[model samples]
Target: MTTQTQTAVIDQLSKHRTVRFFKDEPVSDDVVHTILNAARQSPTSSNRQTYSIMVVRNPETKKKLAVLAGNQKHVETCPVFFAFCADLSRLDVACEMHGEKHVKGLESTLVSTVDAALVGMSVNTAVESLGMGAVMIGGMRNHPKQVAELLGFPNGVYVVFGMCIGWPEWDKVPNVKPRLDESVIIHHEQYNTSSPVPQIEAYNQTMADYYGKERNLHESAWSGPLANQLKSPRRENLRSELESLGFVFK
Candidate 1:
């Protein structure tokens, strides 16, 4: 998909609305295993691999997760679901098995979180490469405690986020969304603030147009949405919940 193999890799990235359906097709377990294997093979900090992935196949679990995600039906309908977790309890057990006490704190927690996110992204890469449809569900953090309870999470483990995986609807393949200029995002050896505001505004305009056509709905651009975040209630109590679950985030 590009001039070279390296650029070809970048060219395959999904942007904007991407895919949401697959004309009655379903992803097979073999393919799912391959994708998960690729993700497991991803590099980890200190090779700890302090993250775990939980696949949800139960209809009831999907239904509950949909409710937790604010009634996002795509979450329920997707053929497969995966909950990526930042797991500290795994390490705790390993340490205890070696006759050592749990010495992990914020640093260990941070590593696990990073490991989970990186592996999640890696799984996405592997799945998308196989022509399977996928979407990330960061909304799992909206009700972290509720999700954890529902999933029967242990004292040292919690869900960082979840994903909806499936085949794309033939008619629902989405176009590439607009992105900010390379100049605005890519800085050299140091940060430069010559002026990204104007570029951001321009990028917002492009995104607005994309949203309008992609969903056939009228939507506001970047600046308006940027201002609206102030009025929103952020449910990212995941850190505090993690602490309650026995994780030491410092």
Candidate 2:
């Protein structure tokens, strides 16, 4: 790709936003597989690469699963949807074949999580590069067991998140949402907070202005909304849900 192409790609990435609704067009199996192929090429922990993606094409299943993910309706309407799992089951099988009960301990759970996240991001980036759009459904964590049952996931595997993918829908196409300034989010050798204060303040104002115009909403600062989200606790039983779905966060 030329410099102009690269610049356009980056600009598209910068403009990318989570699409909540999608058109009725279907994504072909070839395209879905290609997207997953990109995910398979993502970097993983020590190249252990413990992750699996379950593409959900069944409408009934998607509908039921949508309720689990905060009742997000896009799960059903999106052309293609996928559930990325942090899979240790294959390692468990490998260990069993080696006559070991658990060669990879619970500590390795982190690696699988990292692998899954990496692959998910890889698929997202690839999709964006292709001019498609997607939104990651982290709310899948809110119903681990339900999701596992819906997907018929095996033991030693847990869904890290779900993703909705499709061509951009008209009304759902989004404007660029600003991000934090570099100084606020990036840190050098030692984590520096003092220097980020001004940058954060500036970013908050900038994003506030953007939201006010685009959303026709008030110019509220970032911290307030973030704090509000943090203050509203997640489902108290989420840990138990993970445990039931075979992830013992020990």
Candidate 3:
């Protein structure tokens, strides 16, 4: 008997790559509507649907956003930029409509954030399936408050992350990035508590081969740079800033 081939969705997911450069082309409103409609079907927690997307197309706004995102030019150049926000403001109003008090706590924060992430992933998948390219910008959290003010966001809403989508400049596109091996990331049934050092070392060499040809880097690709980055706190003020935006951690 012949083995069945993997599904189309699996094939598409396996070839995922981050496209940081894009061609000077526009994504039409019809396409945006179609993608959003599909992405809105992504599952949400308790049907709360506690997320919002800020679709930015204006060059001036994109320019400011690019600066706020640590000079990520893709934010400015991509035909469309999506700021996926964890939004509790709608829920706050819903509570008020029923004469109930809206509670702000860690549970709500996590739900909204996760909801935003799920929708963003859906959007990315849809974009790629349609032959466009995209990249997620995590630097949106770098200056959360400033981003909020710039985008005129109400209280109880903050950008969880941003996405850039457009026709890719194929010539400038890089190879698919390698991920940690399944042995390191996946466990059978229960969590595996063994040392992952061996797997990591092997993956590092694999990355070295890939990066050496692409980026001319021969250093340990996985662990060494990660260790240096984790040595110091990143976005140390993120907690305080999110608190100021009405998110509760307790």
Candidate 4:
């Protein structure tokens, strides 16, 4: 690619932000097709492509999903919503077609989940490149059973997450949030976990300032909320839920 093209790509990536507010407009079918095509090009585990994307456009369905997804308004308001599923059902059929027995367990679940995540990120990047905006809604997992039933998902299929896509309300678009310093996350060859406290402190202050100024919320540090979250079990029923959906993460 030319330097200009590379720079354009970098600029587009750097400007990514979660857009909660959207314009009262619909995305063109051509654009949707292009975005999904990009997602299809993403790499998958063992070339199995163990994932599925469901596009939801009906208002009533969106409303119901919004409620299920912790009442996120973007789920209801976005012109398009995608439910990305980690699906093993297709793999089962493929194995049967080839006269091979399908054996699914922890490894299979991990592969499918990774495949779904990779495609989801690819779709997000594609949306951003097209000057559209999106937000991933992990809250969809909060009530996986209900979400699955609502979408008529069969056993061996489950929603990994949802994405809301639309033309962002430019005036209300948020700035790109800060991430942890690379030093804290990236290690040189050997693993280095000597101490990340300082890095965490710095990042927390940076995030606190950003939230206070940009989001009009007061927070002393990011670690506090994260620590609080770790103090208790979250989604304790996820294991049973996954088992019910034909996943044996053993």
Candidate 5:
């Protein structure tokens, strides 16, 4: 971690934060194309590249997408929005051209989803490195069917997530969120089975300190909120909806 050894990419990554507020500045098409080209170089499963990016710049379209993404203002406010989709539509076409049928199953679903995620992360890094800010919108899944309809997605494609990129409102940008202790998360040669309760307890305090009095989430920090969230199944309709859209989990 010494300055001499630290790379620019590592430095940028270390300072990463989810930016929710943005300034009224548009991201140029040139910049978007550059970032996307770089991101497209990300490794894919068997070079299938089973993902598509939907770039949205239309104000009205962004407005509808914002509503679909649980009314997140940044989705509408950001200069550019990108929907990273797990797409098998292209694959189906490719197969048809070769006189073969495209098959779908659990593995295909996971591969396409992972491919989208990888490319999205690359795009985020590229954007941040270019002095812009971005936030990934998991809320894209809150109403997947509605989102697909709004965006005109094909049956063999679904958004894995969405991203909002724009110039940051520096005053509103939050501090980098702390992650779990390396000991708790990163295992050794073999999986470390020792209790992580101690590390998690320590992280809860770290998160509490990070949240501070403004947030007032002192006693119940990281784990508490997540526990509450996981108490019941979230996104109950996700499976059926994805299935209806032609994704096969099993």
Candidate 6:
């Protein structure tokens, strides 16, 4: 019962993957404008649009950003890089203009973060539809303070993540990775976790097989590495860093 529009959208989404290697070609300003315009159409919390996208094209800036993002070469090589930021500074100005006291707290932080994520994902989808590829750089959070300083982010603004976009190397394109089974992820009208372990175990086997064939890696299960990763705190200084950026999570 799928319509043409639904099928087309689903096909595009199904083929998505993190494209790291790209060709050394420039993306035109017209394409960039179209992609960003698509991103701007994403929904925002309370219609506040508490987000900003920093398009980085300068070679030196991209080089420094690559270093800040754990020396990811793609950041430096991509024709277009974008820093998606959660921004409350504009909201503060709006409140001032309306003669209302600005509220800065955990709720505001969450809202802005969600807004930025929506825009970022929308941009990703738009780019992919246009036959371009992109990869998100969560490593931007490794040194949030430095990234903020380099980007000249003001108080009440912080980077959610970075994205590198360009034409992907066709030979280096990766397989469409498998995901968790719908039975475990989707619940009908309620939260159901009954017998989730078996579902996870099955998915682990599927992923392990995929990795063995695609990556030539030996792994018992996908969950093992992921579980180990959660044993330690990631970005231990992130809270203090966020506080310094004027996000009081009170």
Top lDDT: which candidate number? 3
Model 6 lDDT per residue over 45-74, tens place: 989999999999999999999998889999
- Candidate 3 lDDT trough over 10 residues, lowest sum: 2-11
The lDDT, on a scale of 0 to 1, for candidate 6 is 0.91
By summed lDDT, the worst window of 10 consecutive residues in model 2 runs over 1-10
- Stretches > 4 Å off in candidate 6: 1-6
Q: Please say which candidate is ahead in TM-score: 1 or 5.
A: 5
Q: Over the stretch 95-198, how does candidate 3's per-residue lDDT look in tens digits?
A: 99999988989999999999999999999999999999999999999999999999999999999999999999988887988888898798999999999988
Query: Which candidate, 4 or 6, would have the higher lDDT against the true structure?
Result: 6
The TM-scores, one per candidate, come to: 0.90, 0.90, 0.97, 0.94, 0.96, 0.96
**Model 5 reaches what TM-score against the true structure?**
0.96
Pairs that collide, model 2: none
Q: Alpha-carbon error at 177 in model 2, in Å? A: 1.0
lDDT of 5 by residue, 1-250 (tens): 5557578998999999988888988789999999999999999999999999999999999999998888999999999999999999999999999999999999999999999999999999999999899999999988888888898988888999999999999888868888999997888899999999999999988999988843665765889999998999989989988998889998
Ranking by lDDT: 3, 5, 6, 4, 2, 1
lDDT, residue 96, model 5: 96
Model 4: lowest-lDDT 10 consecutive positions: 1-10
lDDT tens digits, residue span 89-187, model 2 = 887787789898865546677888889998998899888887788999998888788788778888867889989999878575657788887776778
The clash count of every prediction, one per candidate, is 4, 0, 0, 0, 0, 0
How well is each residue in 218-241 modelled by candidate 1, as lDDT tens digits? Answer: 566766776898687676676687
Off by over 4 Å in 3: 1-5
- Give lDDT for model 2: 0.81
The residue ranges of model 4 lying beyond 4 angstroms of the native Cα positions read 1-6
lDDT of each: 0.80, 0.81, 0.94, 0.90, 0.92, 0.91
lDDT of 4 by residue, 149-210 (tens): 99998889989999999999988986898889999789999989789999999998898889
Model 1: residues >4 Å from true position, as ranges? 1-8, 14-17, 216-218, 231-233
Q: Candidate 1 — what's its lDDT?
A: 0.80
